[model samples]
Target: MTVEEVVSMVSLIEELEAREAAARVRVEELESQIAELMARLEAERETWSRLRVTRETVAEVVAEMSVPDTAGEPGPEEPAEPAPVRVVGAVMVPHWREGLLVDALPDVYRDIVEVVADASTPMQAKQIVPRIGLPAVTAKIEGTPGKLKRLVERGWLTEDQPGLFALAHRATVESGEGAER
Candidate 1:
């Protein structure tokens, strides 16, 4: 055809190419954003899955610890051992009595209770959990200082030192729950 018509067609083609380049760049940007969002979703999903598993395991451990071998019940694939006896308020009480005293407790507290009772000496909260078989954490209970501190609140136990606890005389009373006033 004529050069002028050919030039006009070429200009239109160039403009179309520019638009296609802009569309390609936009597509690339959207793809990058989608990739980042997907990565974040995966990380969040992994965190939630880990937390769910942790909650289930902790619930099982606490339930198993709640009853222990206080009765004739076999526990946790481990043979039940007779609770150690200690003189509290001039009466003998199971050293693991604290384990039986509370209905619910944090895992570290449950671990600390059994651990402290079996320990050679009454230990502070900081010392008891680590020395006995618990994850040592300086982090205090929500409103309390440590395991012994919470046990003292339960009234079945008493704190002898800052973070140490001893079973109360009430631990041996007829109620057997240390609810003694």
Candidate 2:
């Protein structure tokens, strides 16, 4: 059209182009920041996971050691206090009687209970399968979910959420307070 109109349009175009380039640079910076934060988050998660596993393993070892070798006869008498119960992961397990408690469970229920008890958070049945070192095929079996549900019903475990499980109170299970169900 006119020279003046063409010049004005060119100026507008250059301004818009500069803004678009600045926006693109900003978007790239934000993307890079997000990627860095995600990497940090993953590293922190791995560290926390390792710490939780170590804590659980130490608790288990301590529990094993606390059980006395009661098989020997005729020792000098000092009135012994009951063993203390301690938190293992998120569950209360007796420092001396974990083995006895596990032994009291039915064969099918023991592994599942142990996995839930040792977890630092509540677990779903699907999650429990791998943690218990069961075959992936076992998760597909209907009985797996049913067994977990039965444990909840029996108060050996608690359903923390609709499908997530955790250990029930140690005293309730150990004292036979919840055994009637």
Candidate 3:
């Protein structure tokens, strides 16, 4: 090749190398910005999660405090007779003589009860896991079937067939009526 042609090619190579280095620096800056934004997003998400938990805890405390003590009288700090609380979209239900059955239930049993209450037909324990959104891995655990049978024994559910279970049709167990439980 001629000297002039070789000189032109060397200049072109130098320009291309400079552009490549600049592109790498820009990419690093963008990556740092992305990492900072991701960290901020995670912090905001954790704050939101904590707020949700605090709200739920406050609601439970208020509900429990609204109920009168077992002595058939208001607490000394409370008014002699507090005004009746009428919850919006809530139906008046007769107080259960046996107390809240759901209060005595474990989380899994309550989920089972809710699933059966919503179902049009009775469900077997095997059928219940997926309907209640339990993980597939949990369905394979031993004693899962026994848990459903125990619900029947506790009078929360009834066995319609050999293996199928349904919610007990009691006043305190019906939908809307016992929803507070």
How well does each candidate superpose onto the true structure, as a TM-score? 0.36, 0.46, 0.42
Candidate 1 or 2, higher lDDT? 2
lDDT of each: 0.54, 0.66, 0.65
- For model 2, what is the alpha-carbon lDDT of residue 46? 72
RMSD of each: 15.4, 11.2, 11.3
With candidate 2 superimposed using the best TM-score fit, by how many Å does residue 40's alpha carbon deviate from the native? 2.5
lDDT of 3 by residue, 25-102 (tens): 999999999999999988986787677556644644554466566566766887864444444432222123354655
| Model 3, position 29: C-alpha lDDT score | 100
Choose the strongest candidate by TM-score: 2
Clashes of each: 0, 0, 0
Model 1, residue 82: distance off in Å is 20
When 1 and 2 are scored with TM-score, the better candidate is: 2
Model 2 residue 137 CA deviation in Å: 27
